[model samples]
Target: MRNSVLLLAMGMLLATGQPGLADDAELIKNTKADHEENGRWYTSDDIPTYKIAEDGTVDWPTFSGFRRYNAECFQCHGPDGAGGSYAPALATSVMNIDYYKFYETVVNGKQEVNAAQNLVMPALGENKNVMCYLDDIYSYLRARGTGDLGRGRPAKKEKKSEAFTENENACMGE
Candidate 1:
């Protein structure tokens, strides 16, 4: 009876097309899902890293992430996600927070207050500068958190994928 109820619940969740359920399943199964680009998904653990070339042209997304992070996030989060007097270091925070939580926090914002201090993160879900390149921001931050990328602008990067360009254009309505 319990098994049947669990199965029924799973079926209902699938029918509703909820997002986190799949991530939960992936976690339980110890499998990483493919990262999506242009609504299509592909598996790659190294896709987010900056690539170096002899001439030093950087990848678009990671470079864009640096630009966006400095423009929007650095004021509060500090340079290179190192945290500040006002905000906790995202390089450390992202280590424990799941991607869904990170996404939701950015979209919805968060606030915590106590005798020691008040911490507030403003909502940016509707901001085009953030909403359009959330994936890139995540990629860059993840790289920073994992020590895959270092401080300062990368010297070089791989070429942007066609899917990345398509998604960027679509997201920006260009």
Candidate 2:
């Protein structure tokens, strides 16, 4: 009876278009199903989610992350997110920053000047290459930051899902 009432309330909330409730419910369900870790949600089928193998190979998203990071981010952030002489170490920094902050920083960029140095991060929101694979990059960096994924190319990876392909096509406008 309580479950029925809760379901009805959720239905009504959905019908009313109240923001976040449906997503929250889905997040709750996914969390209950063990699709979340350390506050990061993992949608294995639709979005890029990673898994580590016994021999230390990561899933496709993490692999994609490695590629994307090296291509788009390495010059500024340094190899393996270790930070260049100019930029901060993302491998360590990402672990402390919230997802929204990271997103905002990447998309809008940041500039800070202290007594010692001035730092600038150029906005990449308009760059389709980065935007399209932002999640994957984040996943890889987060994994690295948490020490869950090691530096370098993974030897093996899980296959990409049809949903990922579909989403990628839509995002890329293909």
Candidate 3:
């Protein structure tokens, strides 16, 4: 219920590209990167997000997110999350949906059937390719959703952290 409401509100805001109210920006604004753990940067809210440097260089995670997203998600979500006939535009969707809800939807999947229409998102919690890089994907979409990052590959990116590589290898069973 709450997720639906949040989605609807955010949808309207994204559609208009202007806040209907003064505080609407608050609802859509992505938080700043406050700290890092094991090579991943997170917001003060403790959720994964993106960070772009002054020189248009993106964080390693965001860059990785782009790679991972293109590797699979673009098939349904469309390149750069622009939304396809099969799936909605995730770039905007991520901004409106809270991080936890996004995780839940991606992991558990979502189903809504009605007289109006039918929508289904398959459960991907077990897809190691996606699950292992979930945070990176989220960060990439967050950057896209907030317009902090542009479409296509990033011109520059930070180097991958050792911690990230280890965790990724472990997750991938490599």
Strongest candidate by lDDT = 3
RMSD (CA, angstroms), candidate 2:
7.6
Per-residue lDDT over 1-174 for candidate 3, one digit per residue giving the tens place of the 0 to 100 score: 999999999898798865365554464464689899988888876778788999999999999999999996898899998898888999989877778888999999988878977878889999999999999999999998878899999999999999999999999999
Whichever of 2 and 3 has more TM-score, that candidate is: 3
Task: Give RMSD to native, each candidate.
Answer: 7.3, 7.6, 9.8
Question: How do these models rank on lDDT, best leading?
Answer: 3, 2, 1
Tens digit of per-residue lDDT, candidate 1, span 1-174: 999999999999788866676665454222122555543222354233333234755456767777788888999999998898899888777666766788899999998978977888999999988988776776667667766678887767665678887877888889
Worst 10 residues of 3 by lDDT: 19-28
Task: Identify the leading candidate in terms of TM-score.
Answer: 3
Flag regions of model 2 displaced more than 4 Å. Answer: 1-33, 36-49, 113-116
Clash pairs detected, candidate 1:
51-157
Q: Using Cα atoms with residue i matched to residue i, what is each candidate's TM-score against the true structure?
A: 0.67, 0.71, 0.80
